[model samples]
Target: MRIAIFTDTFLPQINGVARTIGRLADTLTRNNIPCVVITPETKFQGQRNYELLVSPGLSLPFYPECLLSIPNYTETFQKLNSFKPDLIHVATEFSMGICGLKYASTTGLPIVSSYHTNFPQYLSYYKVEIIAMLAWKYLRWFHNMCLKSYCPSKSTLKLLKQQGIKNLEIWGRGVDTELYNPAKFDFSFRKRFGQNKKLLLYVGRLAPEKDIDILMKSFQMLNKKHRNSHLVIVGDGPLRQKLEQSAPPNVTFTGYLHGDELSRAYASSDIFVFPSTTETYGNVVLEAMSSGLPVVAAFSGGVRENLVNRINGLACSPRNVMDMVTAMERLITDETLRKELSLQARDHAMTKSWDTIFNKLILSYQEIVCLHNKVTA
Candidate 1:
């Protein structure tokens, strides 16, 4: 089957949405499915996929790393019709996604959308709180037209339902178990960072929307007794410079990491600390679990849904600095408890395979298409 996926961001961009969509395309290609990824052009090089199409874009203001595509609907549909995809999958709410929606509506083709980011909450962080209601109104209208709208986690789906979204389904994210495994643990991480003490790792975009200020304060709350503890923050974003300026001496920022180095970073850390209340689904939490690192995340969104209290990981009250500090201390103080939780965390991650999720998604697409055809006929 041929599939056309539309998104505002794709390869050369390092965010979760881009990375996840790229993985989906790879999965389709390996299975002999012709997948066309519609995205904004970047400094693309190497052997290009004939199926990947690009459009012009402007860099987003706050999120300079991610693009706001200047979509040409006529050109986009022209290329799309030539490809003749079975259905379209829209992955963003930007211009490119709108192009896909318009194309699908005009052609009476089945299309599905996935909710990735909580843009309204993100807007609140940017001091544009007034736009939150309008954003939700637009989101509800955009997604209601889809045959089925997928959310990355059950908790996320629940939130969407509460917000009056319809035709909701779960389409969870996955980690490369082989790539992010406990076997990747290397003492070299300790040697490089001069980490004689326990390492607390935080991975993902360093932005205001991420609730990163809470994470920084939590690290500082790690009392004088735990001064030996080190925090190694991976990934970069708008808040990087500000965070760096406020961070303590024990904190080391690694900018951004990819591939095996990223795997090693997760496996080497004693605990994974993600205080981001904004995540629709905490992909990094799943990766850290796969690497056998116990996660301490906000007890909200998808993170809470996946974590069993003191089982695989700990879920603290969102933005509660004292709760975060206590949770991290428990892991640091009790070596045996940490090891037990780590084992359980790996076990949990093992069950969430990308193959399983992708196959289910394909089945959902077929069902939606069949239903659409019947109704249209």
Candidate 2:
């Protein structure tokens, strides 16, 4: 079936939503499904064959680096409509998504959407407290118009239900087991950071909403007891310089590492600490688990949904440095417990393969398309 996937977030700027969509595009293309990815002109401008539909885009105010694409509705609508996609998927609730919705409305096409971010929760991070309610109102209205909204976890579905969005289904994210495996662990990678120290790793964008300060503080507390443990942070963001300056001596920032380097970083680490409360579903959490490292994440959002709290990994209270430190300490101090959890975590991750998830998503797409076609007939 011909499909068009529209998203505001894409490559050049790295995030879970971008990675997820990119993977889906690749998978769909490989399976002989004609697909087009409609996105903004990215900085890493190399022409690709996937029929990239670029639009005039501008940088966001608070998120200066990330582009907020001003959709060429007339052009995008014409191009996508001509492509004759049996199904359309809007991956973000931005201009591109709105354009996709408008086109779907006009063309009477079957369309689906995915909830990838918690925008309402992000307002307080940007200090836009006054506009948060209005943002929620708009967000709800935007998502409610979709044929069906796909959430990454049941936890997210429940959260959206509380906010009055119906027709939500769980469409979880998956990790590449071959790419992110325990065997990828290089002893030399750990040596480059510091030797004789048990490395505690955290990957993903270093930002306020991530509760990254709590990670640094917790590691500081963890150090007061376990002085030999080192904190290694991967990935960079707006808060990188400030976080680096404020962090304790034991902390090492590796900027941003992707592909093999990122996999090695994950595999090399003894434990993965994710303090982010803002994740709808933490992709790094899955990557860490697939890398065979036990995760210690906040008990908030989708992190709680996957983490079995001591079974797979520890789930501490959100933003609680002491609790996080204590939880990490529990994993660090108990080798047998860590090994058991790591095994369980990897096993769990194996079960949530992209093949399985994508198949289910395709089923949803077919269901929507068939229903829409029948109604029109």
Scanning candidate 2 in windows of ten residues, the lowest lDDT window is 42-51
Q: Which residues of candidate 2, in runs, are more than 4 Å off? A: 43-49
Tell me the TM-score of model 1. Answer: 0.96
Runs of candidate 1 exceeding 4 Å displacement? 44-50
Per-residue lDDT of candidate 2, residues 24-83 (tens digit) = 887777777889988877664534446678887887766544567887787888888779
- Summarize candidate 1's per-residue lDDT along 145-174 as a digit string, tens digits: 787899998888988998889999999888
Predict model 2's lDDT versus the native: 0.85
Query: Which candidate number has the best lDDT?
Result: 1
Error of 2 at 248 (Å): 1.6
